[model samples]
Each structure stands twice: as C-alpha cells, then as structure tokens.
Target: MASSEQHYILPRPEFDKPTKVLIVISPYYKAIADDLLSGARAELDAAGASHETVEVPGALEIPAAISIAYRQSNFDGFVALGCVVRGETTHYETVCNDSSRAITLLGLEGASIGNGILTVENLLQAEVRANPDKQNKGAGAAAAALHLIALSRKWGRSGREIGFQPEGIQIAGKAEGPTTA
Candidate 1:
C-alpha cells in the first residue's frame, strides 16, 4: 500500500562548498544495515557529498553518537541508519521512541540530521524498507539531511548583529552617546 502511494521527491540540493556528512549506523541487522548504507552512499555520491560511517551497539546509541560527532567534528550533516524490529517486550517501543526523540532534539539544536532509523513490525518490513532497490529509506534520509544543510547554509547567518548594542556605538547612523575614557 505504501509503495503504491505517490511520493514527491525533491531535487538533490547543490552545494557551493564541499559538503561532508557523518553516517552513524547500528548494525543489529547486518544485512539490512548494509543495504541501507549502500543506498545512503550512492545518494551522497550523486550529490557530490563525502561521508564517513561509524558503528554503534544499537539503535538507541545512534543519536548519542551523532550528538558526539556534532560537538566534536566538523561534519555538515548527519544520517542515522538502523533497524528496530518490534520484539515481545516493551523495549521495542522505548528504543523506537527515545531514539527518534533524541534525533529530533539534535536537529532542533541546529544539527542537520536525516533519520533513517527504521521502526518496523517485523524483519520483512525492515528488509523491504531498507532495500536500496525498494523503499530506499536510507537515501531518503540522506536527502532530507542535504536539504536541511542547504537551508542552514542559506539562512545560517543574519547580517544584523545580535544582543544589545554597546554604549557610545552608533545606532541607525547616529551616535548613541558620547564615548567615555
């Protein structure tokens, strides 16, 4: 049903400067992770963006890895790739929700992130979504990050200065006041 639905994909964004991305993956399902990584790599290559991949123990650690990278590295964007298949316990829900929320919080903090972590009911669904020839959620995630990166570059800075203007500084072409000392 999802496959039948029409989806609008945006044109790949162009970068004026060299773009670098960090991909953090949790390879719990090695096969699925491979397919997702392949798709993400292909998409990044097509957009002329370079990327580096790092592994973590599981899905919950993906966001933490990205957060660390965001603070320590100079990557322009991040792609989070992993598969969380529902299990017998409530742990599945926790992993799915918490990881997603953390990624969202990172994005809100001005980190350009594309979340490709798959939360599915079963392995079959994960396989379908992770397959490069099928859903290609990995590529989709990369694209999302790229778009956000473009937006960040576009409006990242404001020409106007922030905070209170210093005393004796000119305001609106007129001097605020006399300079002291």
Candidate 2:
C-alpha cells in the first residue's frame, strides 16, 4: 500500500488580473461531493478568484460539463470534483478511467481543468481524501487549474500561428491569397 504521507502543500498562486473559475461537481455521493465542493470553494476564495458551481449526475459528466462551459462561458479555468468508490462490477473501472481520460484530453486542448474525481476502494477512503482537513484533493485540483491559468496568461499565444505568409500575413476573408506587405 502506498503510504498516506503529506509531502508538501503549495501556496495558492496569485493572479495579476481578476480571474473567474467554473466548478463542475458530481453530487452522486452527496456528502462527499459537498465536502469536495467546500474545499474547492475555500481554495478559490483564498486565491481571490471568483467561481460558480454546477452539479452533474455522476463523475463521467464532469468533463462534459466543463467542456460546454469552456466553449460557452468566459471563465478563466475550471475545477472538476467527484467521488468514485470501487464497486464489485467493472463499472467502477469504466467510470474512473473514462472520466479521468476525458478531463486530461480537455486539459490538453487548453481547457485549464483541475480534476478532483476520487477513485478509491471504499467510502471511508473517499471521505478521508475529500475531507478539507485531510488530503483535500479538491483544493489541490483548484490550485492546479489556477497555476495553469497563470502560466497561460504569462506566456500568451506561444507564437504558433499557421497558414500565413511569413512576412505578409493573410487577412481572414479578405482574399484567397496572402495579402502583400
């Protein structure tokens, strides 16, 4: 068994500009979800970031909800919170893996998401990890999203523009060919 050790807790990052974050949570396990939301909200508050919360049916819906908000809303980042306790059937594995993979894919696509879905063996484990005083994974996830947002702001537009003349950049919908300088 992996030792449950508290290694280090990073301080909440500071933002130069005001930031808004969306928190998407699955309240299937009502008590656990509430605890997770509390931790995440506390972290966002401490960092001086404003946030809005939305509830879904289960862990699998977290990534989907975040994706929708990412496209439709102006939020700077997102925090996904949920608890998945392992069951006897293979459904446990499916939920855990699919939710995690979707969250990762969204993050890769510049969604700036922090995944707080807990994959544990039992309810006790979930409670311990979700507890604000204990592992507090929800807060950790919020911090991760905040860090990514700060990094994104620090280094804007990575200079990877494509389909343009090196010198004479083509204007959109002006002409079929590149505009002359």
Which predicted model would earn the best lDDT? 1
lDDT score, candidate 2, position 150: 89
* Residue 131, candidate 1: C-alpha displacement in angstroms: 0.7
| Candidate 2 Cα deviation (angstroms), residue 68 | 0.6
For model 1, the stretches where C-alpha displacement exceeds 4 angstroms are 158-180
What is the TM-score (0 to 1) of candidate 2? Answer: 0.86
lDDT of every model, 2 decimals = 0.94, 0.89
User: For model 1, what is the alpha-carbon lDDT of residue 25?
Assistant: 96
Q: Model 1 over residues 1-181: C-alpha lDDT tens digits? A: 7867789999999998999999999999999999999999999999999999999999999999999999989999999999999999999999999999999999999999999999999999999999998999999999999999999999987455667777788656777766578
